[model samples]
Target: MEFTTALFYVFAAILILAATQVITARNPVHSALFLVLAFFTASGIWMLLKAEFLAIVLVLVYVGAVMVLFLFVVMMLDIDLDKLRAGFWSHFPLALTVGVVVVLEMSAVLWRGFLTVGRQIHGDSGNIGDTKNLGLVIFTHYQLAFEVAAAILLLAIVAAVALTLRRRKDSKYVDPAQAVKVQSKDRVRIVKMKAESDRVTLAATEKQGN
Candidate 1:
């Protein structure tokens, strides 16, 4: 076998193992860390496949930014591991059935030469191929789908921000609009007073009453 092919197999094995660990690990943080490893290995596989743009994006986007955020979230949340695992046994049969159905479907599709079509497409690429050509095809043919995906992602981001803005009784937050609208005239009071004569007249009236 070619050296690249051997390395591809190695990376694939590691990727699969890491992915399985991601789902099977009891600790949420550990699962996230394993997912990061899976991303790294998948990036390596993409590199071997000569998809440099995808490889770099996988490392930068998933491994660097997304995984870091996931790690922080997992650490900050108080997840009960035992509670999470409690229903595993009850859910196992349904999960296994779904898994088997998915596997069978994948096998039927792949066995009918779908996987070969992917290899054929990749094999037809020239030595000078780059992300520029990929971008052209995506923008020209799949522009609508691309835009829809972006819109979906934007909605997800807005939803996340809205959820984070939910009212919390224990939290103190400032209203920026209220702060900005305050004027100097509204903040200060100017008081003018007479000299000690006015004060002495007020004191003499009190003494006469006594």
Candidate 2:
């Protein structure tokens, strides 16, 4: 077998192992680490496919940023592993059905591309993984779709913020309107009183004791 094919198998094996560990690992941190490994291996596979941009992005964005964030969150959060596992069996059937549906859908879409005997559809050969070309194509050919996707992402962000900002009894927040309208007198009171001497304080204390 060719070196590239061998490398593909190696990466694929590592990816499968890492993905399995991601789901099976007891510790959330360990699962996150395993997911990072899976992303790395998947990046390698993308590199092998000459999708250099995708590979770099997978390494930089998902592995570097997203996975690091996931690791930090997993490490910081107090996760009850038992509680997490408790509902797993209960949801297994639904999960299995969804998984099967996804697999079948993906297979249906991708099986044709995997066929070696049939005439394969060739893409632009000028620059296989050129970021410039990719950007131009996206901006020119799929500009509307891209803009729609961006809008959708923005909407999702807004929705997420709205959801998290739901009024809670425990959440302490200041009203901006009230804060802006507040006067110095409302915030602070100046009580002009005579400063008593320590001797007077002691006499007062003694009198109180008596």
Candidate 2 least-lDDT 10 residues: 117-126
Best by lDDT: 2
Residue 92 Cα positional deviation in candidate 1, in Å, after optimal superposition:
1.7
| Candidate 2 structure quality by residue, lDDT tens digits, 1-210 | 999999999999999899999888988888889998899899889889878998899899998899888888878889888888999999999999999999999998798667753663233554546677778778887899999999999999999998888777898988899999999999999998766797799899999999
Shift in Å, residue 157, candidate 2: 4.1
Using all chains and alpha carbons, the TM-scores for the candidates as numbered come to 0.70, 0.69
Clashing pairs in 1: none
In order, candidate lDDTs are: 0.86, 0.87
List per-candidate RMSD values in Å: 5.8, 5.8
Clashes of 1: 0
Candidate 2 off by > 4 Å: 116-128, 155-210
